[model samples]
Each structure stands twice: as structure tokens, then as C-alpha cells.
Target: MRAVACVLFILSLVWDSVRADNSISSLKMAAASWEGELPCKEWNCECAFKQRGCCCAATDLQEVEDQIFHKVMDLSRRVFQLGDTILEVLGGIRVAFTASMSHKKTCFGPFTRSTPIPYNLLTFNHGSGYNPALGIFTAPRPGLYSFSFSVYSKVQGEGEKMYYKVQLMRNGEAVVSTWEDNREDSEDSSSQTVLLSLEQGGQVYVQLLSGRQLCGNIEGLNTFSGALIYPTLT
Candidate 1:
């Protein structure tokens, strides 16, 4: 009877060992078979353990998913904030090309031989009134930009002479100014170019300064043109 009992005990222990081994093998197979749900696959020990651990593993996976979702939401919000800031900066621009005229009186070209000049000739308060005041322009945008001006004058004896002055102003303050005083009456046209860093709602103008005994004014016959160039937001 004692021998019979020993045999039965041995059989029971062997059966339990086989059952444990089968369970572990089954967990590993399940882990390998699944390829879509988790961050890791075939070689993932954690996944295999989770498969064997049932409820405990499921809880861990849920926590990880929640964390990932929150991280994505945070990144999305950051992107939106950055876009809003860019839009705000773009909206602040307010620079534009306002007025342009010449001495021709007819507003046709920059050169003409008419009196009672069409456009106001810039003049200084000095005795000779030799120097001219700058023509006023307004800024359409608040940013760095480029601008250019052209002037044509007609000499009394010869023909057409051109002289030009360009200036950039910010809040009524002069930021840049350029002058060309070529006295050759034969030249039909003269121009000046300027690059400026300006703020929104700023102003600019052009002025023609007289040199020696020669007096000059902007030529406006049939048409006169002035332009401001800038880059629009992308």
C-alpha cells in the first residue's frame, strides 16, 4: 500500500510540471502570433509575459495607450499656437504705394514744358527756396521692403533735365534719403533706389533740391507713377 501511494504522488507531480510548461508555451505562441496591436512583436518578452499574465498585462497596456494619446494632443496644441503667432505677425504689415506725380501738368510722362506745375515742387524754407521738401508716402506694411523713385526736369534753354531725391520715413522720422544732382539738361530721366526697414503705418516721401541757379520740379505730363515693393506672407 505504501509503494502504491508513492507512485501516485510521482505521477501527480509530473502532470503539474507538464501543465505549467504547456501554459508558458501557449503564451509565447500567442505573443508571436500577434503583430498589429503593440509597439513590439515576435521578440518582445514583455508581450509574452503579458499574454501569460492576463488582467495585469491588459491594465499596463491601457495605461501606455492613455499616455501616448495625451502626448499627441499636447503636440497638436503646440502646433496650433505657433500658427496663430505667425498669423498675428503677418497681419501687422501696412505698407503701400500712395501718390505719384510729375511736372508735365497733364500726368502723362515725367517730362513736359507746361507752367503752373501739376505736382507740388518740394521747397526749403531757405532764402533761395533752393531745397525742396520731400513728398509724403504711407507705409502699407510693417516690415523690410524696397522702393524706388524717378524724376525728370526740363531745362529752360536746352531740353529735358532729370534730378531725383528719395527718402524713407518712419513715424514722421527720416530713416533714409538719397539725392542725385546731375545738371545735364540733355538727360531726359534720373532715378534713385532705396531699401528700407519700416514699421506698419509708416510714411515716406520724395524731395527735389535745387542746385546753383537752376530750379527744378518733378515732371508730370500725361502720367506719373510711383511704386512700393514688398514680399507677401507665404
Candidate 2:
């Protein structure tokens, strides 16, 4: 019985030795199969037989990180551009104007048709929105605005009819009017103030009605003015 037990133990050792030799042979064959082929296409890698997948994983991870970095940089650039655009829009929102008829003592006419009264004297034009030559105030932006106009006249002789009609015009339409048609006063003056909601490029001005004459404007009292109350942002 003792001899038989010793023999069984020896057989077990032999079986273990065979299994170890077969495992080594399998590993050698796998190495030989990948001897000429690269485990990773872009980088050199020394991989063990069981760890061959480790080579391409690191390269792939690096590529993914590079892509993520570029995406972040692009997003940052877009945000900066948007900020600059907002600043430019805010900087352009200013409007104010004050102007009057020419400083020289003069009379504005009785024309066959209604004519725009040219205010050639510029007191202040913050945004260059008022044009003296054209006798027009162009709105620089959408906003509420205040406008005022004054008309003054003196008849050639006492008891003569003081006949005049002047209107504040918006886009060729009358918004307000001031006139002196009665003979009670030899010289007369009138003024009007109005609040207007304007869009970009809207125009406003003063006009003399047809067959109406204004005189005795020596003091630059005949004036037109406007200012932006507030901007409407959307």
C-alpha cells in the first residue's frame, strides 16, 4: 500500500510538468504570429502575450483627448465673439439734437406749396442725426423721443393780417401745428412740443404751410430740437 501511494504522487508531478510545457508552447506560438505585425499602428509597443490589447488602447485614449481639447477651444472662441458683438451694439445707442433757423435775420417764405423749414444753425448734434442742409432729423435707433419747434413772425405793417401756419412733420405727415391768422397782434409767435415713438431711419422736421409767411426771426428764436428718451431693447 505504501509503494502504491508513492507511485500516485509521482504521476501527479509528471502531469503538472506536461501542462506547464504546453502553456509555454502556446505563448511562443502567439508571439511568433505577431512578430512582424505592429500591435498599435501609430506607436511602437512592447506587449506581453496576454496584454496585447494594451497597445492600441493608450493611443486611442490620446486621440480622444486631443479631439476634446479642440472642441473646448472652439467653444471658447465663439463666446468671446458674442461678447464683442454685444458691446458694439450697446455703444451705438445714443441720440440728441438741437438746431435753429439761420442766425441771420431773415424771413421764410410763402411758397406755392408746403416747404420744409431748414434749420441751418446747429446748437448740438450728439449723434449727427440732425441734418442742417436737409432740414431733417433721422432717428438713429428705435426709442421714445421728445421734439419741439418754435415759429415766430412779424407783419410788414400794423393792422396787417398775421397769416402764417407751421407744422411739425413726421414722414411728411403733420403731427402738430402752430399758426397766427388773426390781426389782433402785429407780431406773434407759437411753439409746440410732442413725444414720438420712432423706429430706425424715421424722419421728423418742421414745415411751412402753403401761402404762409414768417418774418422777424432775428433772434434765432425759430428753433427745432429733439432728444432720445430711452431705447427699446429686444
For lDDT, the strongest prediction is 2
How well does each candidate superpose onto the true structure, as a TM-score? Answer: 0.39, 0.60
Cα deviation of 18, candidate 1, in Å: 2.6
- Give model 1's TM-score versus the native structure: 0.39
List clash counts for every candidate, in order.
31, 0
Clashing pairs in 2: none
Per-residue alpha-carbon lDDT of candidate 1 for residues 1-234, written as tens digits (9 for 90 to 100) = 332333233334344445656565554454445444432222344442455433223555678899999999999999999999998765443333323453443322233321211234432211121112244444454455565555454454563444434334445455555444555644345455667665545555543323311234444321112333454443
Model 2's TM-score against the true structure: 0.60
Which candidate tops TM-score? 2
lDDT of each structure?
A: 0.43, 0.77
lDDT score, candidate 1, position 29:
53
RMSD of 1: 13.9
